[model samples]
Target: MSTSLQVGKILNNNNRITSGEIMGSSREGGGRGAEEDEFLLQIPEASAKVPKDAFHLAYIFYFTLGAGFLLPWNAFITAVDYFTYLYPEVSVDRVFAVTYMLVCLLFLLFIIGWAHKSSAYLRINIGLALFVLSLLIVPLTDLLYVKGTRGLYSGYYITVAAVALSGVADALVQGGVIGSAGELPKRYMQATVAGTAASGVLVSVMRIITKAIYPQTANGLRSSANLYFSVSIVVMVICLVCYNMADRLPVIQYYRDLKMQAMNEESKEKGPLSGSAWRSTLWDIVGRVKWFGFGIFLIYVVTLSIFPGYITEDVQSLLLKDWYPILLIAGYNVFDLVGKSLTAIYLVDNANVAVAACIARLLFYPLFLGCLHGPTFFRTEIPVTVLTCLLGLTNGYLTSVLMILAPKVVPLQCAETAGIVIVLFLILGLAVGSVVAWFWVI
Candidate 1:
């Protein structure tokens, strides 16, 4: 039995599963699904001759939007040198992780509850505007107040507030984009997921260029950090424009119309949408996809605890010096991109194996620890760098696989809410993992 089957069927009456959901998950990895030939009927959009994706514009837009949402986060974390210099007393990375993830998680819960009533369109537009504002905070603060000085503690608090603001923006954008993409085909979900890795890679590249061009001085770190936010701001503007225009695209609208049709049918059958009706439906959707959420939760709990925090703070290198963390981060980002993009070629259909892999990633904690406290050779740069890349690779692949699978488990109409629930679990994992990163001393 599949993991979903083993846990519990989504419906005993088989009313919830639709043809698109079946085909999306089943035809994966070239597996001929059970009795799929019998149910090879078309969903609403599929019933009509599917409109062309129009030079794959919708796909590219989604990919870019995926990349867009994470850029601010990457900017803040990758600017650790600047933040650390300004506030030497702080555990900069862990604190940022906690602040960002928790705020995002808390706001995400509210967004999920209010999601059916509000427009994701408005939420995303507001989010992109906030991203622009938050990305501007650090550089502007430094220019106006901090200068190149060290130990100005006021700057630290301002920076933390900016990080929290970015967290709120992330909750709005990530849930909306993922939820919207979930309403489409699985490949678009892969595009969105892969684009997330691309954001990491883009920031890493910026780190390389900035780290190389500037002299290794206090002034150099500040310049690099400002440059990071500057580029992020440009990307945010582009995303805002693109996302607003995305609603007009014929390909995107076709799917939106189909979802609306399904929703209307649902409303007609069940009467007007009341708060009570939504609450019951919300719980039902959550129950259907809880196992998938558990896997997503586990994935981030393992990843966030180790990455950026451990990669930047726990280890060191004589030759690489400050460059060591930059290079390690770059390597992880590259492999992460590779892993996320791999779903385009082949995906794991077996949920049992996918979830087990997430659990197996706990082994990374011991392996990374070995790099710090083990034998002389193991403590060297090569092993640590390799481990970091491996961490990124696993994190990317499993995240994409499970995200793509989660929405497919429910009926088409509930797919968007399922996606939002999965993202809530994702942020929840990040919040927990940030706390866990502190316990790394054990």
Candidate 2:
């Protein structure tokens, strides 16, 4: 049941998102012209005093949730070698990707439609539970059933089902977490977004560590795969505990009460958020944030198309031939973390420039193509490495910028919906990008 006071982060329109705190009475240009602003509005504090984040616990909780939600996909795909080794007939990685993305996109669509009727707290808890369940399936099944055997088609299907379950969990947690963060100040949003990049870096670093430590034999592969899911399960449990505790924090509750006050005032006048009224409001919020959503969409479409596919398959180095793609991926992830963190330092509040930068990312195509087709110098490791770093940097920063900016421009009441709608666009972009990667490079 929905709590009278919210159990997760939420948003209301306010001009007060500066330096990243959730509560304030002031608001920026909340109308259509918000898009035309010259710079982010001045700090303009609200009439009421803002409460502190209280030891940054709320901040840490949001960041952990962001990282936790993405870990399932990372765990599954990172352990791809074992899945393939166990069942050689099928393409394990591609199958898992298709199933997971499809399920996530579909569930996210359902969540967006019924967002007003549901609560972020319920969705997130259930999602986190599902994630733990999905992670357990892998290590447990391998231990009890597979027993280091090969050509186990039954085990393969079960693993794919777990991937699909994780996708459902992702759909539940990701939008709610981002939407929840949207209701708070900008720093929490920054933390949440940055944690996503941190997840990639964490997985990459762990993969490297496991590669260095483990033998290349079948037994070694099984052990490494088990480690990935075991560690992921521990993180998900931490996320669940941290997430439940978030709403109880003084800092988080302060903003929840603030948003509740606005909601109560609106409901008293409008006589509850009726279905038609909510649908109309949702459409308006969608209109307000569509351009920002487009920017997010383009960002993922570009990043995913080039990332694992181009880096993993198209390029090679004489010295780092086998390690080339691994190093390139690690570099991309570290720089992506750097880019997401940059937003906390200085956010580009102008919507026009943010969208334009996303469009500018189209240049990545030719530059990356040059790595394959252009002169030796352009096609070499240095150029590819530089371009890949640029790709991750642009992808991380622009995604963080758009995700943070979109809902803040909406009515305070509709901000959470706006954030979820933005996620709909993001998941769609990811799904499309995955498809495009399959057919890319002629």
In lDDT terms, which candidate is top? 1
Tell me the spans in candidate 1 whose CA falls farther than 4 Å from its real position: 1-15, 22-48
What tens digits encode model 2's per-residue C-alpha lDDT throughout 321-398?
Answer: 767887898899999989999998788989999999999999999888888999999978899999999988989899
Error of 1 at 176 (Å): 0.3
RMSD of 2: 5.5
Error of 2 at 194 (Å): 0.4
Model 2 has an lDDT value of 0.81
Worst 10 residues of 1 by lDDT: 3-12
**Clashes per candidate (backbone, < 3 Å):** 0, 6
**lDDT of candidate 1 at residue 248, scale 0 to 100:** 88
The weakest ten consecutive residues by lDDT in model 2 span 1-10
| Model 2, residue 432: C-alpha shift (Å) | 0.3
Question: 1-442, model 1: which lDDT tens digit per residue?
Answer: 3322311233333446642554342232234344443443322223233356677777788899999999999999888877888788888988898899999999999998998888999999999999999999889999999997888888899999999999999999999999888888777899999999999999999989987899868989889998999999999999998888877887677667656655665665677666899999899889977887888899999888888778887889999897898899999999999999999889997778999999999899889888888999999998998999999999999999999888877777778888999999999998998898878742
Q: Which stretches of candidate 2 lie over 4 Å from their true place?
A: 1-49
